[model samples]
Target: MDENSHPLVKAALIHAQFESIHPFSDGNGRLGRILIVLYFVQSKLISQPIFFVSEELERERLRYYDLLNGVRGDQPDWSSWVLFFLTACHRMADKISTKLDAADKLAMDGLRRCQTESEKKVWVYTFSDPHTTVKKVSTQLKIAPSTARSALNALATKGLLYSDKQTKRNKKYVNYDLLGVLT
Candidate 1:
């Protein structure tokens, strides 16, 4: 059945069928999980496309595979899949809440240590997109390269971000603590 006819039913059916088909030579599992996100978003089950529970699926990787396989094989148990999906949503929501709390603490800490408005802006942006680079920041804020670099360096020195000393000239910076909070 097409997805539009019965969205949730189709999502469950198609998700299982897609797993059996294994359309892609690689990334089929990842793609199946992504389909769940797309289905939720497209069906208006969620207003924002922020509910990602791929980590949860990966954690229960074996059970996820088995469930999908079972559904496709005539031992269909839609309730099991729905319950798992609901549980994943609950778990991901809890994780996001905790991350928001950590982000609040980080923002408050940054506000205290930041010497300039530009530095504060950079700090907040970095907290939001931890793996972003100076070039991207400069472009985002319409600031000079030097200004972006200085702000980034200051945040790194303050231990809010860590700079990787790879051989590349445009070194990468990451908010390790923010990543920790998410994971």
Candidate 2:
């Protein structure tokens, strides 16, 4: 906590030490990764707890373990471990930025293509509630179920949403374009 260094380097060192200690019987890895975010947030490096680095680490699982192990070996190699953590953080941030931008563009395009007020409402609702049915949208928007169904179908036709081939009794529509960018 008193380290006079960059937050990323400090977080890397803290994580490495925590892993080396291996305090818990399980969930040590998950908890160690979470410590990085908590440190960042408490240090005011980030205003929110959105800087998640676990996915990046998980992607390079072998290398991540190797580097951590290297740091804990007879001759500790802190440099490689810190560098890998920083690199993973950079890549994760870039990936998040790209996905967010793409999803925003898709949302704006879908809104422009909406034909009616109901369609626009349904499209907007999909942002908050990705999964919706005709009945759900009808209740949420206080619109006729038929009108909700029409708007959903129109969105599906526009390629903004996709409907599953479920029974006609209970059909579901999703904003696949936005979900695609996000997922």
Candidate 3:
């Protein structure tokens, strides 16, 4: 299980070995999945280490455990594991692609609506940091509190941001669509 081998082969081997080790008292399953994503990034298979596994593994939880056990029992079950990995990769790729497409569309629409450079910067900042308060934005952008409030209110009016009315004067605003994009 040297990592210097072919990345796909190494990923499969390391994943199996990690499961065999069961190193952590808890979160071994999660750690193993994280290792898979990290391996993908380290091997340059993915530009970012953002792929997820919980739902995919949960969908086939029984079979996943069975395959791991089979491999531990010295059975030749690598092919099954490889197939499962490919299926997970496909699912993750599709999910991320859809998200990127939607984000791009939103960016284009937002850009078209934002006329000034400052407004465009505000939109970009909000998009990047969703669920932030006006105070935080003001502090980050070094703008006056009033200016920050105005920018946020304008975005909210355009249906790009929403907020839960907090009792405090410095209320928190959430980018609802951005959160939706993330989850």
- Candidate 2 lDDT (Cα, 0 to 1): 0.89
**Which candidate achieves the best lDDT against the true structure?**
2
What is candidate 2's CA lDDT for residue 8? 82
Ordered from best to worst TM-score, the candidate numbers read 3, 2, 1
Q: Kindly provide the TM-score of model 2 when superposed on the true structure, using C-alpha atoms.
A: 0.77
Model 2 C-alpha lDDT per residue in residues 1-183, reported as the tens digit of each score: 457898888898899999999999999999998998999998898889878898899999999999999987589998899899999999988998999899788778889999899899999989877888998999988999999999999998888888865657788887767777788
- Provide the clashing-pair count of each candidate structure: 0, 0, 0
lDDT of each: 0.79, 0.89, 0.77
Q: Report the lDDT tens digits of candidate 3 across residue range 67-135.
A: 777776645687787678667667867888899888878877887887666567677888778878778
| Candidate 1 RMSD to the correct structure | 4.1
Query: Per-residue lDDT of 1-183 in model 1, one digit per residue for the tens?
Result: 653555556666667777889988899988987887898888887677677777776778888777766666556776787567567667877888888898789789878999988889998888768997889999998999889998988988888889975536787778888788767
Candidate 2 lDDT at 38 equals 97
Q: Mark the 10 consecutive residues where model 3 has the least summed lDDT.
A: 163-172
